[model samples]
Target: MTRTRKAMVLGAAALVSALTLAGCSPAAQNDDSSNATTYTQDEIDKALSTPTELTFWTWVPDVQKEVDLFEAKYPNIKVTVVNTTGGTQQYPKLRAAIKAGEGAPDVAQIEYQYLSSFRQTGSLSDLTQFGADEHKSDYVDWIWNQVADDKGVWAVPQDSGPMGNLYRTDIWAAAGLEGPPSTWDEFAEQAAEIRSKTDSYIADLPGNDPGQMMGLFWQAGAKPFSYDGDKTVSINLNSPEATKVVAFWQDLIQKDLVATDPDFADEWYQGLARGKYASWQVAAWGPLFLQGTAKDTSGLWNAAKLPQWNAGEDVSGNWGGSTDAVLAGSDNQIAAYELAKFINTDEESALLLANDQFLFPTTTATLKNPDFVDQESEFYGGQKVNEFFAGVSTTVDKDFQWLPFMDFVYSSYNETVGAAISDKADMVSALDDWQNAVQEYATQQGFTVQ
Candidate 1:
């Protein structure tokens, strides 16, 4: 939910030049920010009743159920939901449509990481125009904050992926272990002991997924990147706190106590099913993903919060989450807003997303619903997995943010830091290289580095 906390940007003599290359000038953003168009209830009713059409771009499969609910309620407004390839593939097409001045949808699904980039280009409609700020209480504080900044509410909260550790209690019980560790110091001790005693490593760090690593950094309160939703940018992958994470994993990787495997591949999926790893440090969405991936090991798994940097800390971090943002280019503003608002805030539609689609909830009301959280899982010894992660969602660090040019940042990381991890090389040194590369990219892209 954190937009930013630390001052991480470097200064240019003045704010300038690259974002304008995309045609979003500072003046345009000022117009977007200052013009909060509040509508009367009559205006809202008329907009909903008018025969209007909206194109919605999303990657969520079978989300049409929610859209159907919105259509049934509005009767006059018709929505066409267009599913795209998830983020990496979808974002470029979205940007291209904006540049070409056509083909972009009225409402689009956007991850928290990419929200800053679209916001930088002035491509997102300010939901504040329709009094979006008033519904802030509907979501968890941290999740709500990620969709908002001083500019305006950029998106409607949809789903979230707060991180937690899912471990094999059966594996630990064989060594007389009762539960997961409370602190990372204890985790390391157990990781080594488990490797020495069993056939499994405690977990495999994903060498290819920086998002998972960033979630770890978030838990440690490292300020990896910061942008003011304008020209100023900051990056510090090698910050003292973040370096601790790099060094700690380095020790485990070098000692052969943890495996750095490319995630979401055939070999990785096999590793999970066969118990090559005893735990997964994954997002709230992970429990269900693991359930389906490791059906052979049903009733052997359990969930817990990530081990803290210091004992007794209740901090966690988010790995994935998305919002429904209406594009600023849309002609159907009110209808678009209604479609976004309905799927997320309407209890039936929201709960349908949770119960049927298995998208982890962002709305606090849905998160607290007894029917949503009280369910037991036969796959994890009847544990109330939703109840556990719903609590974890509340503990996620509230000040984390992303760079506006994260597309480049993420690709570059795979070559530098991610490459080093796969080679089992010095992550601390690699962090420095990643830092230099990102800073150089920022300057070349015309941001005022902080």
Candidate 2:
């Protein structure tokens, strides 16, 4: 999930067109350097003690606080922080650097969905070979799974977004509801009640957000997209499970229980401020965002688990989160991997990432710590929103996957399913159109779409 502060989309053309490569030979493509994978304790010590300089590219603000911890622990290694534009902008520039054989950072922040794309270029180092796999037990299962595949572990889990329901407690109270809905049936019933009684929508289903739509599909256990970081892939946007999800939302939109509004815009912000919408199905990162965007609604909200699909089951889908990956061409793989791991896993760094930078925690140590989860939010009616979301984190499905070409997938989704959503058309048929467009694009991209 892209935080409100970061760019939500990446454009490949921006990367290609922005480059002014100087004196680079056409043969200088995909610089797969001879970086070592494993290191002895002595080797690590020697590496850290050496006069080394490393570059890190990330979009997180105030990230220097975390970087300083690493530098303090290993004084000889100095890290240069670069605010590489996130989403489409970050990856293309990274790829350009690898092709140019220079100016690439030793470590780069990568979203889970885009990691496969970098892996496809063979430009990310396999962290598994450097003792990274041992930390698999340290992270949340879904997050650890995101950075690994059949090939190897490519990155360290930084932060994650396990989806949850955030609602206006006063609106629910006005509707004679005491807590969040336990099922979609209850949710819809409450939607009708909230609208009828209070003139407020249950939520806004943004027509432009494929990530949100995909997260819902993921929650339903629909494996709609998959790629091998190579030639083989799968697309099942029209699967029975996915159809069930699409149809559910279609019914809601048609009934006028929810609003059709694109998010991250002034109108959307105003909706939150004016209480036009009563609830948001958002990632853990959303509470801090909502506090800043909807200050007038402070203390009127509460957090809870997303409504269950099955009567008594618990499950969730992730909307946004990212990792720190060491590039394959880094001359200092030992230092790079250590830096990525340290910032994410070290207690001081991880806490600072959560408390200071507002990144939702991925490490179990940080996720469950009373220091992180025990605090009540003034904006959420004194609810321990972090604790609520931490509980939701445990229920996330561990098997969600993404296409390597998610940039295209999301763009295409906005054009097809999103358009239908906005126009109040037949979403079931729109799903078919989305399926066809994605399948055709996958085939055109030379993938063996299954």
Q: Among these predicted structures, which one has the highest lDDT?
A: 1
| Runs off by more than 4 Å, candidate 2 | 1-37
Cα RMSD to native, each candidate? 8.2, 9.5
What overall lDDT goes with each candidate model?
0.89, 0.86
Per residue, candidate 2 scores C-alpha lDDT tens digits across 157-256 of 8888899888999989998887889998888888899989997999999999998888888899999988887889999999999999889889999999
lDDT of 1 at 133: 92
Number of the top TM-score candidate: 1
The TM-score values for the models, in the order shown, are 0.92, 0.91
lDDT of 1: 0.89
Provide the lDDT at 395 for model 1: 98
Per-residue lDDT tens digits of candidate 1, residues 1-450?
Answer: 111211111112123335566565553333332235565567678989999989999998899999999989999988898889698878999999999999999999999999999999999988876878989888899998899988889999899999999999988877566689899998899998889888999899877898898899999999899999999999988999999999999999999989888999999999999999999999999999999999999999999889999998899999988999999999888889989999999999999999888999998999999989999999989999999999999999898889998888888888888998999998889989999999999999999998
lDDT of 2 at 414: 88
